[model samples]
Target chain A: MASLIACPHCGPRPKEEFTVRGDAGITRPAPDAGEDAWYAYVYLRDNPRGRHREHWHHTSGCRRWLVVERDTMTHTIYTVADASAEGETA
Target chain B: MADFALLHRPALADAKSGSFGAPSTVKRITLAALPEGHVLHVLAARGSGDLQGLIPRIGDGTPHAARPYGPGQWFVIGDAPLSSAEIFGKTPILDGKASISDQGHGRVRIGINGAAVETVLAKGTAVDLALSNFPVGHSAMTLIGHISALLSRTGKESFELLVLRGFAESLWDELIQMSLEFGVDAHTGK
Candidate 1:
């Protein structure tokens, strides 16, 4: 069986309860920035190999958004935090 | 009052009795609807300092006793009308803390008890429901045949499942199919 993500609100639950939104930590360009920046923001993505930060929604459990730190190579979850608290997102 | 919608759900329109399995095998499993009652969601912000002062001896206890829901929340299930507002108004309730909402109408509760209930549940959920892992009074939000549900063990051999109203009948049917071999003692309020 795969590892479970310990939800801060619902305790340790299977990964199925969450839906990974996308890579976290990407900053949006300021409104006046060129179209190239917007293109990168919308389409381009870094498929990094390790120590990736991501955003996931606990759709089935607490219904809270979470920021998850995971390793892509091994699928190991480092930590999970409530998105509303940290106020950080990609 | 206990007119909470959590007490009932619309029955499956085309359920065929005795199709899954006959209730001939008895004593192995028992299923019933717990009494009708209101269910509320009381959430204390995670890391919010104190919950003690919030209830502050509501005559004896907060109208309905609370049960495990999430890390910062409790399900105030009761036979009486919800009293979450009386004790804690829209104010902060002390600090920038705690919130409560009536979940009665949006969810439905079903009780499953007897020896083989775990066996029936294990068919669907991956989480271990063994007594050693999930003892009495323990609760967790999990999936039951693909539907998100709150699973609470109320006694040595009893469990209460809270599922969204939309998925109640589907879960009920799936549970029945799973309990076919063990036999289900069907009760009211499906």
Candidate 2:
């Protein structure tokens, strides 16, 4: 149960409206990068047990994509931000 | 409507006189189709134009509610369909590069009334519907079941919901089911 996530626009709502978009910190490999880089970028992932940053889509409401920082094990959402403009509001 | 022989049928074509519970029950929740209205999805963001000028204040001295479901975005609803270009004809905004999309036919609006309306809504949505919290003229985007729904409180005991055209029937069914525990009075017309 993902409880509630506060959407900067619609306020706190049930998480059902969102579809987790996965880790937000990963950078895509360069187009010219070798196969090893592409392999790592596409296959490798750090399953951090503690604090994690991920992207979530508010599919049902504002349709705004957001980045959420949370404690993986505790499922405590520390903060959120607009995915399109990470430096701005959550 | 992209060319086939589109059937002019209402979503709930077979709702029948199927109503559950009695009007004398604890509280009555009435669900019905709202009078036809126009909806505009306004994307008036950081670089967008001043949307405040588009939706004017009504006779009550209160401005018509612009539902801001996203940051810097609003959905302006009116009794008659009003397109952005039609409303703003020759005038153009230099500041706000606001984008407006007409959702007149792509969305469905339903009205929920009666004293038990709040109770029925509370069963699915998390927003506080208390009179002090979500009073009349208040509107917010929230989910009812898995569907994204824009809830606007029209009165103390009445609310209107806007959802995608495809999900109207499902949402309507869900609302009726939720109202079952309480009391639901269904009718074909207002």
Candidate 3:
């Protein structure tokens, strides 16, 4: 697991302060979308091994939603940005 | 009406006090429970731009009166208690750009100071407490040993912690434990 996350607002902090929400790429399906689409949107997720973007909440710090791009295997963080700034917060 | 009235009590009334750990003079840490003063939480209205210049208008004109913990959020503190009307009176200072919520009854301040204050705080938090990285008057909302608290630098060797009322004692204990090596004198009065 990534040991530290450089919060865009609070700077570098230990990962223990954040709560991971997993898979920032997923989008909410429209209410009228098909059942399969809704099911996939609600429950399906990709367990990628390489670079991935995930939603993490700085629960104990600045309390901001951040999008963290990092590698699952190497645990090297590539980028950390405010989720709202990227227009990606759900 | 109920038979009993709600009695107000200080958060750390029963907290641990006195000295502990290795005896030392140069590295001794002083832990004090600051006065139960007014703590006002301010939040910027949506789309409100930088309030760096306007927020101080609500402060009590004391040094470090306005402490910003996050973007668009701040805690205006003072040593004097305030009434609800007094708190609301400062609303117009923001001119509708921000709102204030009274946190006086919910939060409390703890003062810790010593030559090794940074070293003791470092054991619990990851923030760089060096004077260069965290200058005086800078505040950061971070976890200190699983407890959420706002840490603020006040002087070369002194720092203050603003924590929720329910967790003040726990954090106090943890702070003492962290300073055991340097010896600590805790005063949980007033």
Candidate 4:
């Protein structure tokens, strides 16, 4: 496989330079949260017909965050951005 | 970007300003090369305040669109580097506990610019690429064909597409074919 990839956090990189984490948007239940909550976090999914968020790890590349959007049914990706780039203000 | 090294400059400068700024002058910049191992020490956040004003104060400040990720989360584009530090200084940050390593996995980045950018994207992407909803600055991640990538719209006719190393060549070919209708010129590196 190729080695360099664009840093999901940064941008434009080689594949060998990064690692692929699994899908994004994995939620965990709180310690006191009930089994219903845990079950929903693990098993249930919204699987919307429109935009969907997922996670990817650029393990080998620059250590930054990434948030991706793709169609739930079509698997078509629309865009990618630094998960941390969210502005601090309203 | 005939030279790969030139592509190191942010996509915003290329699309919006058309002139690259001095690397040292760049604020909120990430000045590290590709590391080895899987590095996951990343801190991400979203701001609910005036995105319009905050855009210029940080890095490039160019107006790019944004998108939703997870619950109550959005992936936006700005001149700021994605780190634990604060830029907007008003928005709240959400942190992840997972440990990430600096594994040098191969990757490649390509920018799609042209009036038909959305149309080209729609060829392989499933999301609605309408300008009204998916306007500039908006971003998201998902699979394009078999490749998992990060896509960000940095301008009205421009976007940044991040494809994994393993699928770089394949995705590049696909992008070339898709971009043919709009006339694309991709620069791998500076």
> Highest DockQ, which number?
3
lDDT of 3 at B18: 93
Query: What does TM-score give for chain A of every model?
Result: 0.88, 0.87, 0.95, 0.53
Clash number for each model: 1, 7, 0, 82
Per-chain TM-score of chain A in candidate 4 equals 0.53
lDDT of 4 by residue, A4-90 (tens): 334444344444334444356665667889988888777776656766765555543344556656566765567767666643211
What is the lDDT, from 0 to 100, of the residue B103 in candidate 3? 97
Report the C-alpha displacement of residue B132, candidate 1, in angstroms: 2.9
What stretches of model 4 exceed 4 Å from their correct place?
A: A1-90, B1-68, B71-107
DockQ, each predicted model: 0.54, 0.74, 0.86, 0.05
lDDT string for model 1 (B17-128, tens) is 3334555555356655554456667777667865754633222253225565555666666555444565455335436576667776667677787778888888888767
Model 4 chain B is weakest, by summed lDDT over 10 consecutive residues, at: B28-37
- Tens-place lDDT per residue, model 3, B1-190, is 5599767799998999999998999999999999998999999998899998888889989889899988899999999999888998999899999999999999999999999999999999999999999999999999999999999999999999999999999999999999999999999984
- Which of 1 and 3 is the better model by lDDT? 3
Lowest-lDDT window of 10 residues in candidate 3 chain B? B1-10
DockQ winner between 3 and 4, please give it: 3
**Tens digits of per-residue lDDT for model 1 on A63-90?**
7789888888888889899886787545
**Which of the CAPRI classes, incorrect, acceptable, medium or high, describes model 1?**
medium
| Prediction 2 TM-score vs. true | 0.82
Off by over 4 Å in 3: B1-5
